[model samples]
Target: MSEKTVIDLSRLRKPDYNGSVQELYFLEEHPEWMVCKTMPGGSVFDVGTIFSIPNSDICRTALRHKIYSLLETPEEWENIYGHICRKYARDKEFLAFLSEGPLEDFRLRGADTHHLGMIDRDTGEVYRKSFPPHPSQYVLVKKYKIIKPSRVSYNDNHLWDYSEYYGADKFVVPLENIVRIGLTSGSSIYRNYLNMNDAERKNYLKELGLREELVPWTLFAKPVVDFTTKYEPEDRSLKLQEALHVSGSSGKKLLDIIKMCILGAILVSEFFRKIGLFLWDLKWEIARDGDKLVFVDTIDTDSIRVTTKANYNNKDYFVNFNKQSMRDYYKIMHSQWFEATKSAKAAALKSGKSFLEHLRAGQAEGYYPGTPQVDRRFIDIQEDKFNTLIAYIYGQATLDSTIEKYNEIGLKEIGYYDANGVLEEYDKLNGMGEETVVRSQ
Candidate 1:
C-alpha cells in the first residue's frame, strides 16, 4: 500500500453521482478538482475494491485508453463528427418549431412524430456506418493536476474516505459474442440472437454453419454474443434524467457506441488469447464530450468477465480470473441472504424508502437475516487470484508459466507462439508503444 494523504474535510464536497462503491468529491474552490473515493473494507457481500492496490485507478485508466486506441482513426473522425452535428441541427429545428407553433397544434403533431419514432429526444436516432472512436478518449484530469495535499489531518475515521483524485458518473454498454469481425449488421443481430427460442437457435446455427461452410458444432457453442446497453431502472434513470439532462437519444447514442466497443473487445480478446485467457464479455463506461462520445473510467477485471475454454461451459458460472467468481460464490452459497436482500429492496422501493433502511428495519423485527460472512478461504483465494490477474494484465507476469498453462490446457493446437514476443505484443496492444497524447486537460 502507498502512503495515505491526510485530507482536510472542509476543502471537499460530495457530488450527486456518488455510487455504492465509489464516492465522488470535488474541491470547494475548483469543482473540476475531482476525487474518486473508494471505500476500504467496503465489500458488497465481501467482494470489492482491494485497498492494497493503491494505484489501481491509474492502471485501470491506462488499460481503458489502450483498448480505445485500437478504434482511433484520424481520417474518419471528421466525418463521424459531421453526422452528430447534423443530428444536433435536426434537434434544434424541432425545438424551434415547438417553441413557435401553437401549443394544441404542436401537441397533435408531437404524438404522431413520437409514434413513428422520427426523432428521439432532441438528439435523434442516428448511427454511423463505420467504426470510429465512438467514445474517443476523454481525459478529465491530467496526472500533474492530481495533488496529495497534506499536513492538515482531520480525524474522520468513522467514514473512511481515502480516495484517488479524478472524475465520476458512468454508463455501461456491453457487446456480447454475437459481435464478430464486422458490425455491419448492427444491434439487430444481438436482438435476434437474444430472442431466439431453443428450436430457433438450433436451426439458426445449422443454417449459419451451412452458409459459412463450417462443420463443427463446437464453433456455434463457443459463447453467446450480442450488443446491449445497460440502463438504470426507472427510478434511477429518472434521477439521471433530472440531474444530467440525459434523454432517450443518450441511450440511442450508447447503442451506436456499441460498434466501437465491439472492435475494442476483439482487439482485447486477441491479446488475452495469447496468454491462456479468454475475454468472455466486458462492459464499457462511456460519456459525452460535447457531441462526440468518449470512453471514461477504467476497464479492469471488475468491468469484465473471464473464463477458460474448459470452464466456459460450466453451469455453476465459475469465472476464471474475474470478480464474477466471487459474485457467483455468494449467489450460490448465500441464497437465503440474497433472497432476503431482493425482498427487502423490493419492499423498500414499494414504500419509497432506501434499501438499507428497509433492511435494518427487517433485521430489527427479526424477519430478515444479517449480511452473510464470506469464508476466509474464499477471500484469500479471491485476493490471490486478483493480484495474479493484475500482474498478468500489467505484463509483469512470467509468460513462460502462463504459456505452459496454455499448452497444458491444449490451447497450443489453437495457436502457439514464442513467449518472448508476448511482452512486445503487450506494449503494442496496450497502446504503450508510442507516447500517448493527452486529449484533454
Candidate 2:
C-alpha cells in the first residue's frame, strides 16, 4: 500500500466556535477513510477526484427556495455554483476533510440526494462501478434500456434518449439478500428492508442479532445489473454476459475487462454525465439470491448532463461546476496532473516501475492536481472555520431540513438513535454564523 499523504491545506483558517463533535466524527469514521475489507487500517488518498453533479435537483431545490433565480438558467447555475466552489475550496475545515482523501471515493453520497451509497457484501461481491479515470465491469441490470419496447411513455422516451441507459439501485431487493447496512448505500438498503415481509423479516433480523428495525449499513445487498430472457440479439446478450464475467473478476482479469468497457465509456461520459459523474449511472447490488444476473435496465439518478459551452472541461476536467472560470482552475490542475503522470510513467520505465507503482510512489494519494501553489490569492485561514463552512454546505446541499423531517418519521416508525443520527449530525454540522458567510465569500 502507498503511504497515505494528506493535502497541504494552509489556505483555510480555524473558527471561533468548535464545530459539531458528531459531524467531525462521521467524517473521520466514514468507511471510505478505511482500507477496503479491513478495519483499523486507513486507505490511501486519491487527489484526482472531483465532486459529482450530474442532475439538476440541487439547482432546482435551490431555485425553488429562491436560492436560485428563474433567470438562473444552466449557464447561470455555473456562475453561482462556481463562485460557491471556489469560496468553499479555500475553507480550512474543508481543506482538512479533503486532506483525509474522502472526496476521491467513487461512492454516490449526499444528504438530499435520491440515491444511496455502495454495499459491501460478506460474499465478496462488491458492486461494479465505473470511473472516468478508470472503469470496472458493469452489468446491464435494466433489459428494457438496451432494447426499447412498449409500455414506455413518449415524454420520458425523449428524455431517456439522451440519458445513460444502463443502471442499478438498492431501493428494493429480496428479503434473503438483505445483509448489513452499507457505508454509503445504507439508506437504500434500509428502505428496501422496510418493504420486505415484516413477520419473517423480524425473525430473520433476530437471528442476525439485529433489532427488527435497526440500521446496519456497511454490510448490505445492493441492486446490480441482472439480465433475464426478456431481451433478444444473441451477440448483445453474449457481450453483456462477458461484461458481468469481467465485473466479477479480480486482479489483472478486472483490469482487462475495464479496458474493453472503456471503448464505450467515453460515449457513456458524453451523454450520461455532464461532469463525468458515471457514478450516477451505477447502483450494483450484492444480493446473492442464487439467481442469474439479469439483463434488465432501469433509468435512475436522473441522467442528463446538460451544460453550456466549455462548462465541464475548460476549467476542471473532474468537475465542470457548469461554469467557465471555475472550470479553468480545475482544468489546470487536472491536466497538469495527467501530463505529469504521463511524463512520470515514461520516466519510471528506467526504474522498472509500473504506472500504478509510479502513482503510489509519486502523485496518487494526498495529491490534488494543481492547488495551493497554483492559486495567487491564497489565504491562511483557521481550521475551525473550515469545519463550519463544510458542515454548512454539506448539510444544506444534502437537504438538511428534509432529512431532519424524514429522520423524525423514521424515529417514530423504528424508534432507534441510529435511526435519527444521520439527520441529527446534519443539524449539528450546518447553520453557522454570519462570520461563516463573510469568511467563505
lDDT of 2: 0.25
- Model 2, 162-214: lDDT tens digits are 11212322221211111111212112334345677978668645543344253
Q: Against the unseen true structure, what C-alpha lDDT does each candidate score?
A: 0.38, 0.25
Best by lDDT: 1
> Over the stretch 1-441, how does candidate 1's per-residue lDDT look in tens digits?
022223343344555345544455554544433444432232343223322323333334334444444334332333333433453364664334223322222123211000000111122221121111221111122111212212222452111121221132231222121333221111234335456787766665453332232221112222222333233221221122222222223444533444344434544676566666666566554443344444444455656655554221121111245554544444455667767766876675565445767777887898887667765545554555444544555566887766555333322211111132332222221111112111110
Off by over 4 Å in 1: 1-18, 27-247, 250-255, 309-318, 348-352, 403-441
At residue 390, give the lDDT of candidate 1: 46
Query: TM-score of the candidate numbered 1?
Result: 0.48
Worst 10 residues of 1 by lDDT: 111-120
Question: Using Cα atoms with residue i matched to residue i, what is each candidate's TM-score against the true structure?
Answer: 0.48, 0.22
Which one is best on TM-score? 1
